[model samples]
Target: MASTILVTGGTGTLGSHVVPLLREAGREVRVLSRHGRASADGVEYLTADLLGGEGLDPALAGVETVLHLAGGPKGDDLATRNLVRAAARAGVKHLLYISVVGADTMPIGWFRAKLGAERAVAESGIPWTTLRAAQFHDLVLDTVGKMARLPAVPCPGGLRFQPVDAREVAARLAELTLGEPSGLVPDLVGPTVYGVAELARGYLEARGKRRPLLPVRMPGKVGRAYRAADNLSVTGALKGHRTWEDFLAERVGQ
Candidate 1:
């Protein structure tokens, strides 16, 4: 089991943490990335681009369990489908995937793509488990931080976010990888939920910046979905304990 575990997106936010934990547990970890960088000692780095369907079969040669985390701005479904096909060809045992909480019902391009990817996973014929998680705290804060530079920062109204920590998600993924494949595990969310405006203010406070908050009410289906708080999983697994404030204090306060 240890020698056959392969983690895609090994250089990303969640994968960075997941790979080390796997290695530390004495699992022989192999990473497949476009950049192909060595993250840990004795870990193998395989080159592949899922969307292009290049170099995947070789990567899956000896890999049994694949923790799929690689994604991009678009073509998420294509990438996942490619990987799924390759996994099936390689006779992979279990496929673990990372997805967003609202991917199933949300009316957005990214969400739709993610949902499509989920379908591909389900139909792949590989024993699979997918964990839908709330937004990551770092991603939320990064967005807010980028907008905080403007004189007036725009905030979406009635939008609630339960931002989980990437490391916390990584830990859960590790646990899932170690265990048997349970199809579509419960969502992993943050300890608390906060409005977008509240998160924006928190970001401003953490960065020691003062900007006028311009509340925006979005005018489309996507905006309506956000307004309805579709992103918050009230009855989810809620595995993450780190709050946005905790993330801010540790990452931004430093």
Candidate 2:
């Protein structure tokens, strides 16, 4: 039997892409979902709750590697703790965690929770590889879409983000799953960074909508951290080729 790789949040945005890649690589893919009825070719679905620890034992059976992508919107610290304990109990050989960049340096509540989760994974005694990647392009699109829903789009002044392609990130995670569990590899970031306002404009243009973008100067340490140059990638760790322009162009053509 081929090694089964369990992907938490396998139906989600990033996981959807990762699942296919793993299947293509000839690895048996098992998805842990709440619904547990969804199906994909070369993959199996199992019902499991990360928070409640339900159905994990059966889902984890015969699983050698786990790509843990399930987490709350604002970083539920409790969920990570529970997941770490569950992975350890399952005797999983390698646990791969996807985290955001600057999670340790940022003072935001979400970052704090992520940091706690990272700590838990590190101490879980299970072989683990934690990857800190920049913001996703889909997240950029979501931000713009939310703004378009509002009366006006508010762009944070001096805020910049190095947004990466979800497909690229998923590829890296798949590669890591096939290798030895090295703790906390180098950070992954996009080829370039762009201001939030400019990105919003690009998004608006791509979607064939021109909305008034209101740039606002946000206060606090979190805002400062976003504006800081250190928060972005200055050297190559894992460099992505996709750009916001490419993402927007594809959107425009669609």
TM-scores for every candidate against the unseen true structure:
0.97, 0.93
104-183 per-residue lDDT for model 1 (tens digits):
88988999999999999988999999999988987898888888988999888888888999999999999999889999
> What clash count goes with each model?
0, 0
Q: In model 1, what is the error at residue 11, expressed in angstroms?
A: 0.7
lDDT of 2: 0.83
Q: Write the per-residue lDDT of candidate 2 for residues 1-254, one digit (tens) a residue.
A: 76889998888888988898888888889998777675668789888777777777778887879888877766556777777777778788998889888778887788788888888888888999999999899888888778877777898887888889999999998899878999999888888888878888888877888788887987987778877754676675688999989987886558
Off by over 4 Å in 1: 38-40
TM-score of 1: 0.97
Backbone clash pairs in model 2 (N, Cα, C under 3 Å; residues 3+ apart or in different chains), count: 0
Best model per lDDT: 1
- The TM-score between candidate 2 and the true structure equals 0.93
Tell me the deviation in Å of residue 102 in model 2: 1.2
Give the lDDT of residue 236 in candidate 2: 58
Model 2 misplaced regions, further than 4 Å = 38-40, 149-151
